[model samples]
Target: MIEYRIDRRSGVATYVQIVQQTKQALRMGLLEPGDKLPAAREVVEATAVNPNTVLKAYRELEREGLVEARRGLGTFVRRSLGAAPADSPLRGELAEWAARARAAGLERDDVAALFAAVLDEHFDSTAKEQENR
Candidate 1:
């Protein structure tokens, strides 16, 4: 199970943060289908947010078909965000790359920005190639 964290200074709403973090966990394969999310009360206790905020996040996830809430149990992951398998060879390679980046003194945000830029460039080139075809 993934623990939820909230940044009150983030300017994003607390409920939205909860929902986005859950989705991010799903994307990263930390939360898989059938995994139970922390109970709303648990989240409230952990984050000191209103119970309704947690419920709202869960409801939004349900609306997105990512999770389901059982009557007596708790919200469970219904689907993943289609990330590569955890054991994929690319994951190992990426880990090594991240280690190298850290060794090179790149901060996490800098690495993330570099990655996002490269990903965008790759997709843009692919789209242009498709258009040419």
Candidate 2:
């Protein structure tokens, strides 16, 4: 089971946040197939969000084939997003790198921008390399 959190300051829609967090949980292996998500009432109670917002999020997940809502029960995970574990070597190295970046005076946004650029470049290059092969 996963607890829901909302960041009203983020400017993102509440339902979108729920959808993203659910997908993130899938990626992190926190929610596996067959795992029941918190009831909409539970989410509403926890986050003070509208029931419709949670239902919208769950519906989006269902459309994406990531989850299914049973008539009598609750929404359940249907698929995984396939992410490495948090304790993986790559994650540890990235955390260390992030710490170093912070120590070197890089702000959170700067670090995120740098990482996104590098990730785009790496994937682009890898795709080109595959094409060449």
Candidate 3:
């Protein structure tokens, strides 16, 4: 089961936010194959979003082959994405690093930008190396 959080101030669309959060859960091992997604009505009630919005997000996930809708039941995860588990050591190290950054007075946006730069530096170089090989 997952809880939906709606950020009205965020420029991202509500449905897209749902889809992104669901995929994030799947990647983090919080949700797995056979896990039943909360009913559209449930999400609607929790987030005050339109039922169609939730359905649209679910449909997009289905289109991506990430989930399937079972009539009379609900949507269920069809497969997972990524290799990182919720309790992975890599996550622990990152959490510790984040704590240190916070203690060092880095704002959330500052940390995010720094992390994104590091990711771009490392992952982009790795991708280029693979392409060159």
Best by lDDT: 3
Which 10 consecutive residues of model 1 have the lowest summed lDDT?
A: 124-133
User: In candidate 2, which residue ranges exceed 4 Å CA deviation?
Assistant: 102-107, 123-133
| Deviation (Å) of 126 in candidate 1 | 18
TM-score of each: 0.80, 0.79, 0.83
Candidate 1: residue 121 Cα off by (Å): 2.6
Query: In angstroms, how far off is 69's CA in candidate 3?
Result: 0.6
What are the lDDT scores of the predictions, listed in order?
0.87, 0.87, 0.91
User: Which residue pairs of candidate 2 clash?
Assistant: none
- 1-133, model 1: which lDDT tens digit per residue? 8788999998778888888789878877889999999998888898889999999989989998999999999999999996666777788999999999999999999999999898997766543452353
TM-score winner between candidates 1 and 2: 1
Segments in model 1 whose C-alpha atoms lie over 4 Å from true places: 102-109, 122-133
lDDT of 3 by residue, 42-122 (tens): 999888899999999999899989999999998999999888889999999999999999999999999999998999977
Clashes per candidate, residues 3 or more apart or on different chains? 0, 0, 0
Task: Pick out the ten consecutive residues of candidate 3 with the lowest summed lDDT.
Answer: 124-133
Q: Which segments of candidate 3 are over 4 A away from where they belong?
A: 102-105, 123-133
Q: Residues 2-30, candidate 2: write the lDDT tens digits.
A: 99899999877888889889988887888
